[model samples]
Target: MAKWKLYWVESDGYEDCFVVAKNSRSARSVEANMNGFDISDATAIRVMDIPDIFEEKADKKFRDWSKIHAPQQANNPDLHEWPWYADKWLLEELGAQFRVIDNEEQILLRDIVYAKKPTGEWYTYSIGARAIYERNKDLPQYDNYDNEPRIDISKQLYTAMGLALTQCHEIEFLFSNSFVFAVSEKQKKKYKTFNDFFKGWEKKTLGGLFSAMQEAFDIDPEVKMALDLFLDMRNTLVHGITTTERYDINTDWGQKELLAFLDLFLSLCDPIKDIATSCFEVSIEIANTYLLKESDENIPIKSSNELLSLFINCFKLKSMN
Candidate 1:
């Protein structure tokens, strides 16, 4: 038989209340679960109570917030007095728009996953809710940050994004696209400040995009030669060049080339964040384009593949026209 436990951690201390669910998860699996939940230190176990796990950055913030505010609240200490668990849970309406997840009670996004599957063939998911909670005022500031895996290069990109709000120097982006990105070294001379770096991002992006594509795909000499020619003529900015000395910041062929690379690279990267972002975009487009007021009553299916298909079909149709 498997055992499960649900305990709540607070400034006042721990309590055995909600039974979240505890099973014989393997050490590796348990560790992964802990990482995902942002639970660095584990103690009591159970099933029913939502995991109080939180990002390291946000963890201390929540603890302090709890101490000052509702120290007696039996709910998650991080959310102490915020009605976040109650009012603003995410839910998809008929038109794929979002509403409160479960009535007016507080709920975690993960807890309602299985139940939130789309009513049709395809579905969409968003980590944005997580991003939103991390930034929203209702939740304790620290409840939103996860900092342990700062060494993971891939996730480091996101960690940098989270830390961006705090002005913490974890990762610095040379460029930011829908899902594609390139990070710069701390000692590098490419950018002077956060604002300066991002301001000139689109210009630097094409070089990175071209490089990413050339690496991912084995392009023929003819295609590669042609691409190089066009890139130089239209978008010939160098990626490694990180100086404000005299760089052009125009929406030239470089931006277009880089955007192309981003489109292709995202396909390979499988960035759930971008996919989820696009899913919401598609949902809103569908609602505004086809369905209107009745959109809220309809649950449409919009998957990454479907979005790609729509993109291709629209291109084909436009070419035909």
Candidate 2:
């Protein structure tokens, strides 16, 4: 039997409670029996195991064991507070075990995992959620030696492809939008309206946009090289995958080629980060030089600045673990 520490919100605030039971359902049932109320809502009940040290204390009950380690209120140090239990108590001691009682939450906590690159950056995935669900739900256990590597590699390949494509799109959008602001009034007048101009430029291919940007700004050779390589791989992955027989999963040689491509895609992470950082810097420079100089009533300018800020924030979040 496990000593399950359960938490829920009451009429006023959070209720910090616990029960000793065989599993999560029984634990909730035990709590409901003692308190004379149903508490079986999976969404409301957060569960964790009471550490063995406290559970083994024969002299104290489960509630008493919890109170012994609960956080004290600021106004009265002697009074233990229930509201801080979720954030303070569990996070400080049993952080890993803390999760809501739901299948989705369980899958997120169990299936998703992160890996830190040598550069101290982190990336995560749910180990191919769709593929795992379609192939076999139990495959996520990752204990089958024969199938694990193939699934793991395939998932990583798809994940890397997604990251590459997303970053490339962002780069293209940033440069294309910034180009609109940087161009002279005469150049802008070629289009019927601002929307038309923006849409026309936005429709340009990644290579075409980069080429246009080169006319105005000195492109970093390394950044250009990395992006060009990414565009090439993106084409092969997106277009060639449907047309060519180069990536046949049924053949050993094609399988080797696919695995090699996965390795190459994974290797682009450092360069991709560098190029993204460069694009962000250039976009900021363009905004500061032209967009921000426009009158306050210029709605497009204001919207562009807001979009840039949001992109920066999102990039920061992804860059962190």
Candidate 3:
């Protein structure tokens, strides 16, 4: 058997799919069947023979498990519902939505829009740009005109940090209460005029909030550090860029520091993702599974709570594979 890597374009963007087939002909057959196209006429489909990295990494583990579980797999049809099997099935089901693209081709946002358009809109736009340029080739081009100010957080690292923190907070919030409380008898006495006293406990910054959380609850040190670094990096970005309230992603060290911060952020947040996934399995999975019908269509999440819960479930489901 040969392994093949398939690169396909979809509505969201690009995806890489791997499959195992008996031969070149068998791979083409599988690809054709996956897209519901006539095998002889499917021009968009492409496949490259490659070694399967997953099998290469987990060969021994899979072999050991299969020795004991192969019989059970044959006996139980619902074994397909397991994460590995389910993910493969889901990818196959979604195959019809993707058209094969050349692996070497760098797909731009415009390429996706062009592929989706029914008419030759892409050609028209290209022709128009060429015409204007051809007529005014002597026009002086200015460099970096009215460009947005550059900053460390404004680049790719900022986006990664944002997403990582968002993921971390999804788990953190479940155990954290947003509201403040008085811990001491003296503080509780402020209940006589609670309205003015409550403001005293409000955290001013993300660091302050996490610090307060640490004081009130048994927070993991790693989790606290993650929160602190995220806020500190953010503040660095802000002060480094703007005068008012803003967090800068880059410290004084430049791109190297930005990368270092991003590395630290991911390392800190990775285990929290695992923890959150575990919590989601225990707290949200069964109830949310029945909320939406099991179908191929993209269903709208009806509320913030439902969306948040479903988002974590997706993370949990993804981690299972």
Candidate 4:
């Protein structure tokens, strides 16, 4: 199967998607997509493959996030729902909208096939990636992440998880997890059990996403205690177990710990990407067997329940064939 080592998609800005999608001008349309400001009013569409390095930064973060849990919708096609999935920007807002006044026809964003208009003068840029119906037998490789702390965490996550006793202390409570009894003690009273304290890490991040005192950190007893608690919190959040939070923090605040969590998650997935991807395929087969109709049209491509699927899909990314 063909791969997008480097690519972009664009629209012809037409109301009739099928036709205009096949016929927008390349140079001008691409210019509009790149530079938000317009030099000319002529309708345009394009995806200029700037130097491969240009997309590296965004792709690096995206692939890392995808490996961790970002389901591939258009981006993470394999994963299920994320908290952000409900946002309108990434979904159907597939590409930036612009007025296609020239001779554009179709509106679907898929591929950039160069097709001329019926009037003989204008040609439009097509938008979207065209994939083969069959799954790609080969693996996908993208830009690599070069962050020091994140990369180190990724390397450490799996080994640390396995050797839990030394690598990480599974403290029952975050508030009482740390040796700093004075500070965490007052916090502990609010949580009856250590698990309850853990429940609040995601919720509590919002409370201190910017504060000085940390809830989790590298090799810190307090951080370990806090993380142990958070793992249970994540479990409860997923399994529908009853939970009350005295401390509520954002699960992801884009902080060092969050980056570390991402690194560790991705590192752990590195071993499972292939197995996970295959298992995901098997699950889809099981799903298809129970579906109302098995045809492509009837198959649901995106769903609110695919978060688990997405997580599994990440297991397949950057894996051994």
- Model 4, span 129-224: residue lDDT tens: 122111222535222212212233333433533443222222222222222221233454667754565454335432242121232212334433
- What TM-score does model 3 achieve against the real structure? 0.26
Q: Model 2 — TM-score against the truth?
A: 0.38
RMSD in angstroms between candidate 1 and the native structure over all alpha carbons:
24.0
How far does residue 13 in candidate 1 sit from its true spot (Å)?
A: 38
lDDT of 2: 0.46
Q: What lDDT tens digits, residue by residue, belong to model 2 across residues 24-88?
A: 56555544554566664322344444554543332233346555654242234343322222332
Among the numbered candidates, top lDDT falls to 2
lDDT tens readout by residue for model 3, 239-304: 443222112233322332344444555555555555434433433333345433576443333334
Output the better candidate (2/3) by TM-score: 2
Model 4 scores a TM of 0.20
> Evaluated with TM-score, which candidate comes out highest?
2
lDDT (CA) for every model shown? 0.32, 0.46, 0.39, 0.32
Query: What's the lDDT for residue 258 in model 4?
Result: 29
Off by over 4 Å in 1: 1-115, 120-321
TM-score of each: 0.17, 0.38, 0.26, 0.20
